[model samples]
Target: MISVTEAKQIIRANIRALPSSLVNLADAGNSVLAENIYAAVDIPAFDQSNVDGYAIRFSEKDITLDIDGEITAGSEIIKSLSKKKAIRIFTGAPAPEGADTIVMQENTAAANNTLTINDPALSKGMNLRPRGTDIRKDELALEEGTLLTPAAIGYLAAVGSAKVNIYRPPALTLIITGNELAQPGLPLRTGQVYDSGSFALKSALQLHGIRSPEILHCQDDPHELTLALRHALSESDMVILTGGVSVGEYDFVSQAAENCGVTKLFHRVKQRPGKPLYFGMKDDKPIFGLPGNPSSILTCMYVYVSLALNMYLHKKESLYQPAILKNAYRKTAGLTHFMKGMYNAGYVEILTGQESYRMSSFAKSNCLVILPETETEFKPGYQTQVHLL
Candidate 1:
C-alpha cells in the first residue's frame, strides 16, 4: 500500500553493509574497497628511461662522447657517466649513475665507441622518467569505498598491493516455487508453462556482475514451500522467492516466510506488473518474494533488489533521471506504471508487450519509463523519469 519511494526507503533502512575481508587483487574486480589504499613504494622505484636512447650528462651542443656501458630493461648495471661519456639505455631501464639527460637514438649518431649529438633541440631530462613521478611512496593510491575495476586493480598492483580489503557481495538463494512450471527445452504438459523466470533472473544477476546464485525449486504446497524458504534463508544472505506471493489458494510464499519466523516488511507496492511484490527479513537476511510473472520479477529486481544489494555492499545506488519520451502513452489505472522502454540519445520510447507475464518487449528494452499515478497521459517530447537498465 506504500508508495514506491517510501517502500525503497523502508527497504534500505533495514540493510547494512557486509563485513570486509582480505581478497587477492586478482579476485577483487567489481568489489568495493573497504579500506583506503596507500602506496607502499614509489612507482618505477627509480629513475627510468622512456625511450631507447643514450644517457649522458648534458654539457654543450654538438659534442662527441665516449660510450660507457649498455643497460637494457631490468639491468642492474650502475656505471656512472664521466664528462663527455654516454651510456646506451633502452626503455624502462634505470638511468645510470651521474646521468642527467637522454637523447633519442635518432637524435644521436654513434661511430666506433663515440657518440655525437645530431639534434640541436636535445635538452636535459627530455626522455627520462623520474623516480616516483607516477606515484609517490606513501601517497594515497585509492580511496576507501572505491569500486575495484580492472584499471583500479592494475593501479593497486602498480602501487605494490597484492591483496586488499573489500566488501564482499552477498550470497543469494533463489527458491523457484510453482507446480505448473516446467523447465525450458522440455515438453510442457497440460496447464504447464516453461520456467523462464529462473533463467531470466539468473541472467539479470549476471548482467549486474553478481555471481551465480543458489537455485532451489518447490511446489505450490504450503509445507514444501515453508521448508524451502527455511533452507534458503539459512544458506544465503538474501533469498529471492520467484512465485506464490499473491493471495491465491496455492500462493504460499508469504505464509511460508511467516512460518519460518520472517518479519514481513511490506506485502505490496502501488505499482503495476509487480503489485504483489513482497519484502521481509529473518534475522539479518533480506528476503524478496517477487511476483511469478517474467516482466514483474525483472522489474522488481531492477527497482528494489538491485538497490538492496548495493546498499549491502555500501556502493552508491542508482537514481532515476529525466528523458524525453519519443511517443505518446495513455493509461487509466491509478497505480504507478513502469513501462518497458527503449532509450537512446536521451530519448525513450515505450515498447509493446507490457503485461506482467510477457517479456517480449522487456527483452529489447534498455530502460523503464515511470508514469506517475496522478497523471496518465503522455505526449511526444514529454520529459519523464527514466531508470536505465
Candidate 2:
C-alpha cells in the first residue's frame, strides 16, 4: 500500500498526453489550444465610429459644421470631410476618409444639415475607436495552451479563425465487473444490489466534457473479466473498471490486468472510501480499478480519473484550498479521510453518512474536506484543506 500522494504521482508518471487535432471554431469551447493563434488582420481593420453622431477632422471645437454624407454600420461607402464639416455616422461604421474625431449624438444638437456641439466637455478624438486599437495585424492574439472560453471563442471568430488546433479529449472505456450487481429498473435477486457505480461514473464523466464513453459489464468469472478488460484496453486510451479489485474470492481485476499485459503500479492506497483502488498501465494506456461502493467510486473518480484527463488535455490540475470546519470530527490515525462536505461563504460543513456504501450525503455536498492520515481528532472552527466539486 502507498500514500495518496504517492499513488497520484505514480499514475501521473505512467500516463501520456493525447495528440492535438484541428477542431471547428464553433466547437472549440472548453478545449485547450495546441498552437499559438496570431491575428491575421487588425481588429476593427479600419477606423471605426463608436457612436451615432458625427465624424469630424477636429481642427476646431465649439463650432457648427455642415453635415456630410451619412455612413451606417457595415457600409462600404467612404467619404472625405472638408474643414468645418462632419459626417453623420452610426455605431460601428467606418470613419470618413478625413475624419479623426467623433462627437456622440447625445452630446451634439443637429438641425437640418448643420450640427453643433452641445456639451462643453467635448474634446478632439473623443469617442473615436482607432484602427488596430484592440489588436494589431500579425500580433499574438491567444497563446498556446489557453483554455478556450466563450469570450475567447467570440474573439477567435471576430479574427476570422474558422478552425483551430486543440488537444482532443481522450476516448474512454468503462468496464463494470461484479456478479452481485444489477441494472436499475430491474428486480434484484437474492444477494444482489442495484448498480449505482455505473450511473454515477457516467454522470460524473459527462460533467467533465466526456459526452460518450463505452461501457461494458461482466460477471465475477476471471475469463469473462479478462476478455472485457482486453477488449476495452484495445478500444480506449484509458479503461476504468468498477468492483472486483479487493482480495476476495470473486475479486479478479488484478489477475485480469496481469493477463492483459498491464503493469500494476499500485494496488492500494492509504485513503478512506477507496483504499482498494488499483492503478496500472499497458504501454501508454492507463487502467483504473475502482471500488464498487457508490461513494468510493465517485471519490476515486474525482481524485484520480479527473486528474489524468486534465493532464491529457493540458489543463491545470485542481488545487486544495483552506476552509473553516463548522464542526468537530474524529477518526483513527491510519488512513486519510475524504469527508463529504458542503462549502458556503468560505466555511465547510462535513455532512452525515460518511460510509462508502451511502451516496445520499455526497449528492448533497459540493466538496470534499481532506483530513490527513496523521490527524485523529478535529476541533470546531479549524482550518482544513478542501477540494471543490
Candidate 3:
C-alpha cells in the first residue's frame, strides 16, 4: 500500500493531453484553447450606440435641433448628421456619420419635429460606442491556455470567431464487475444489490465535460475480466474498473489487468473508505480500479481521477482548498480519513452516515474534508483542507 500523495503523484506523472480539434464556438464550452484566438474584425464593426437615444454633434447641444430620421439597430447605410440636427437612435444601432455625441432620450424633449436638450450633465460621446472599442481587428482575443467558459465563448462569438481549436475531451471506458449487482429497475433476489456505480460514475464524468463514456459490465470470471480489460485498452483512452480489486475470493481486477499487459503502479492507498484503490497503465492509457462501494468510488473520483482529467487538458490545478473545521472529530491513526462534509463561508462541517456502503451523507456533501494519516484527533477551528465536489 502507498500513501495518498504517492498515488496522486504517480497518476499525474503518467497522464498526457489528448490531441486538439477544431470545433465550432457553440460547442467549445469547458474546453481549453489549443491556439490563440485573434479577432478577425472589430467587435463593433462600426461606430455604435450603447443606448436608445439621439445622436448629435457636441456643438449642437444647446440648440433646438430638427429630427431628420431614426436609426434602429443594424442599419448599414451611414447617414451624416446635418448641422443642428439629431437622429433618433436605438441601442446597438450604428452612430450616424459626423456625430460626435449622444444624449439619452430621457434628457431631451421632443415637440413637433424638433428636439431640445433639457439636461446639463450630458457630455461629448456620452452614449456612443466607438468602432473597435471592445476589440480591434488582429488583436489577440484569447490566450492559448485559456479555458473556454460561457463568457469566453460569448466574447469569441462577439469578435466574429465561428470556430476555434481546443483540446478535445478524452474517450473513456467504465467497466463494472460483480455478479451480485442488478439493474436499478429490476426486482433483486436475496443477495443482489442495485448497480449504482455505473450511474454515479457516468454522472460524475458528465460533470467534467466528458459525455457518453462507453460502459461495460463483466462477471467475476478471470477470462471475462481479462478480455474486458483488453477491449477497454484497445478502444478507450482511459479505463476505470469498479469492484473485483480486493484480495477476496471473487477479486480479479489486479490479476486480470496484469494478464492484459498492464503495468501496475500501485495496489492500495492508506485512505479509509477506498483503501483498495488500484492504479495501473497500459502504454499511455490510465486504468483505475476503484472500490465497489458508492462512497469510496466517489471519493476516489474527486481525489485521483479529477487530477488525471486536468492533465488531459494540460491544466495545472488542484481542487483541494483550505478551510476551518467547524466541529471536533476522532479517528484511529495510520490511515487518512476523508469524510463527507459541507463547506460554507470558509468553515467545513462533517456530515453524518460516512460508512463506505451508505451514500446518504455523500449525497448531501459538497466537499470531502481531509484528515491526515498521522492525526487521530481534530479540534474545532482547526485548519484543514477540503476537496470541493
Best by TM-score: 3
lDDT of 2 by residue, 168-237 (tens): 8788999998888998899999999999989999998886668899999999999999999999988999
Assess each prediction's global lDDT (C-alpha) against the native. Answer: 0.88, 0.90, 0.91
Clashing pairs in 3: none
By summed lDDT, the worst window of 10 consecutive residues in model 3 runs over 311-320
TM-score for model 3?
Answer: 0.98
Ranking by TM-score: 3, 1, 2
lDDT of 1 by residue, 204-235 (tens): 78745567889999998999989888888888
TM-score of each: 0.95, 0.94, 0.98
Stretches of candidate 1 exceeding 4 Å from the true structure: 207-209
Q: Count the backbone clashes (under 3 Å) in each candidate.
A: 0, 0, 0
Candidate 3 C-alpha lDDT tens digits along 1-389 = 88998998899799987889899899889888999999999978999988888999998899999999999997889889999899999999989998998899999999899999987998888888899888899999999999988999999998888999988878899999999999999999999999887888889888677889988899998899999989989999999999998999999999999999999999989999899999999999999999999888888888888889888876656578899999999999989999999999999999889899988888899999999999999999989999888
Model 1 root-mean-square deviation: 1.7
